[model samples]
Target: MLPPFRPGTHLVFFALLLTLPSQALAVIDRDALDTAVVDAGELSRTHTLLVAVEGETVIDRGWRGHATDETANIKSLSKTLISALVGLAIERDIIEGVDQPVVELLGDRVPSDIDPQVNDITVGHLLSMQSGLQRTSGSNYAGWVASPNWVEDALTRPMVGEPGERMRYSTGNSHLLSAALTEASGRSTLALMRDWLGEPLGITIPAWTRDPQGIYFGGNEMGLTPQALLRIAELYRQQGKHDGEQLLTAEWIERSWAPRTRSVFNQDLYGYGWFRTELDDTTVHYGWGYGGQLLFVVPERNMTIVMTSDPTPPSNGSAYLEQVKAVVERMIAATVP
Candidate 1:
């Protein structure tokens, strides 16, 4: 026959087991976050930083008056938005295909000097930053922006290499894309963004800095709130869906995340507008701009991280990736559900 249970023994055993492995992982370490906040306070990062995991609030601290709700220029990160817009355009039949020769669409806007190489460049080449056109921005940025016509100025650059033979990170290619979109839709790039993305996502473009030509600066200089950025990351995570609506086709997102270029710094493969890195054997895709602006999305971990700052000495994208990965590892340790 079984013996009768001891009065308090069952209760103690259950309590011990509850704390062992069945309990949910803590979402974050408040103390560790406090240290991060303190560190942010001491430095002059361009703006606020926000981190989120699995829809759980992990770190939402702001320093130097930066907050989650505030928006700042995301710089070259805007290129990704432009890329997504192209994907949406493809889905909506705004254009026939990525392989379409861009010169035929630009009409009178095509360059007067018109290198034969331009004929060889395709929409895909531009999107992939392998257009082979001399980069429009550089040590020459000041001069380029000083021009009254950004599109024309960008087109005038020399073709230093054969099209598709090399990868060059150029704002010129993206600006040309904006012009291409303008010509294709008979609507401004900004208008197209509003009709397709901004409205659907409920995200008003916070602000977009423009060039002398008054076109939205390509490849750089756009502003967005932390939540707004999250919405973008989430959009990609869901393969271009927004709030249950299919804004961009799953195929486009797949292509965009697919490797088209390699990271300029570390040989990490780059997609249409995002960088893919292997962290702890898991693939991580992210976006980084000139300053310290970073947006990381880890599908496997169901995690997203965004950091913005005009660091005193410029933020290193790779190092920041490691920092975020470490913190996310801890957060995963304590994740609930």
Candidate 2:
């Protein structure tokens, strides 16, 4: 497995880590980098790796017969896409801004017996996982999804913390946002995703799991090809623009990348649906899904990378995520001026 990182220790000593000077285009050692990827694959069951620097594809490899063009279940990386849709909805005036009350958007799905604090939960709270409602992720995910109505189940959940406080990292929070988008726009998240993002980005997003109430699984089980994921990363790297097209406002990109709070699991700073961390010394904003699915945008390095791993195996408690982070570190270090 890839090496573990101490909480406060910065990785800046790898021989290649400091090899690259402060120039935009650096010649990467392809042979060494490819060998590093192979070695990392042995540590983690990585299926694909796609790297682009300065708008050019530098590395694209799919392991074990997996094709780079084929879509893989991206799991919770879908949350990032969901967050983008939310931003579009706001800009289009589908609903109010992030401060709009979620309970109001949810309407009847909100149980009659919800805590008074539930009214305090807003779209922004849900986006940042500060809904204060008991999380529907982790061990609670099974029960949350198995409930008769996903929106009702999430809305009725008791307030464990104050709204807009610490991060809870709940998929239910995102699912509730999906339901809100549906209610506000009178469209399925999948359909809106197709028109709003898929069409603009020219990426394929197949239908994923839907809840009992027919709301798309907001933060989980979605699928995207590695190339598609890379494009999404590149969009963020270019500050929400692609091919001279402004798909998202630069303000929204800044807000999405800005750290609102920190995740309790990894202690990484979190924004709307992205995680902020450091790879060696460069600040990396990423979207991480279950089973090692990751999309990383390194703004400083002008790099965007996508890595997809097998979703069948458990990743939370395994070394898969750590290994992926380690591999990304190597990739960043390989750049040279």
Candidate 3:
């Protein structure tokens, strides 16, 4: 038989145990995070770094006097925004599913003499960068943008491979998506973005560069604040829900994250507009822009990180990109238990 003794003795012991340090009570180390931010500050090109874990921002630091709220050109990171718009467009039924042929929407823009294969390109092909069209990003960027009709030029470019055959990173593919969205919705891409995302996410959607046809540049030169970018990342991290509303469908989020092709440059898996790769043994999905504008989502950690860098030319090539990724890896390590 157990004796009913004084309860104070047991209660005192339990209280003492609660005060003792335990791994179960461990929280993110702020000092380690501060050190990581210090290291990021040393990168000359990096302007801002914002880190959020579990939907709460822990660090928002700006380097070289840059403010986190300042808008900067996100470069190819705009592709991710375009992808989101496409997803939202589909959800609204303005555009059909990904399988719909893009030419169905842009048929008016297709050149008369273009190859018949152009008709085979679908919305999914453009989102995954598997449109098989000649790239309009690197050396051809100058000439492509200089053309009188950006959409027509992109559609008329020679097919380098079969549609949906392989990933061929091209801004033109993204621009074509913008045009299709415009035609299907009977609204400018900017209007769709402002109504569907900007207003819902409560982020400013500044007007960006427009083509000669007055279409907003799709995959490049979209200006967004780092804080705004973080909110966008969080939206995806939350599987397209925001403020108790399903702004984007969970199905669309899953489809956007599903690996559709491989990037030849870095060997990273390309989904709709995000790139998947391993960092510090953790799977990371990121949106990379020219000159190091980066948005990373670590689903395993419930983390979303944004880094904005100088958009000037001479990107220092992949070497600098690796360095920026290392900075992110360090931040992730700092959060480990």
Most accurate candidate by lDDT: 3
TM-score of 1: 0.82
Off by over 4 Å in 3: 1-26
CA lDDT of every candidate: 0.71, 0.85, 0.86
Using all chains and alpha carbons, the TM-scores for the candidates as numbered come to 0.82, 0.90, 0.91
| Residue 312 accuracy (lDDT) in model 1 | 38
lDDT of 1 by residue, 1-337 (tens): 2345566432111111121355322234345554554554454453666656544545676666777788777877888888888888777787777898778667678868878778887888888888888877556777777888887777778888877765787888888888788788888778888778888888878547666656666678777877788878877766667656777888998898899778566577888888887764567788877666777777765567677776434556567545554554444333322
Pairs in steric clash, model 3: none
Task: Give the alpha carbon lDDT tens digit for every residue of 1-337 in model 3.
Answer: 2234454432111111221264122245566677778988898798999998767788898887788999989999999999999998888888888999998988577778777999899999999999989999889999999999999999989999999898999999999999999888888999999999999999999999999989989899999999999999999988888876889987987888889999888788999998998887898899999989999998877789999999998888567888888878888876652
User: Which ranges of candidate 2 are over 4 A from the true structure?
Assistant: 1-24, 316-318
On residues 195-241, what C-alpha lDDT tens digit does candidate 2 reach at each position?
98899999988999999888999999998899999988988888788
True-vs-predicted CA distance for residue 136, candidate 3, Å:
0.9
**RMSD in Å for model 3:** 7.1
Whichever of 1 and 2 has more TM-score, that candidate is 2
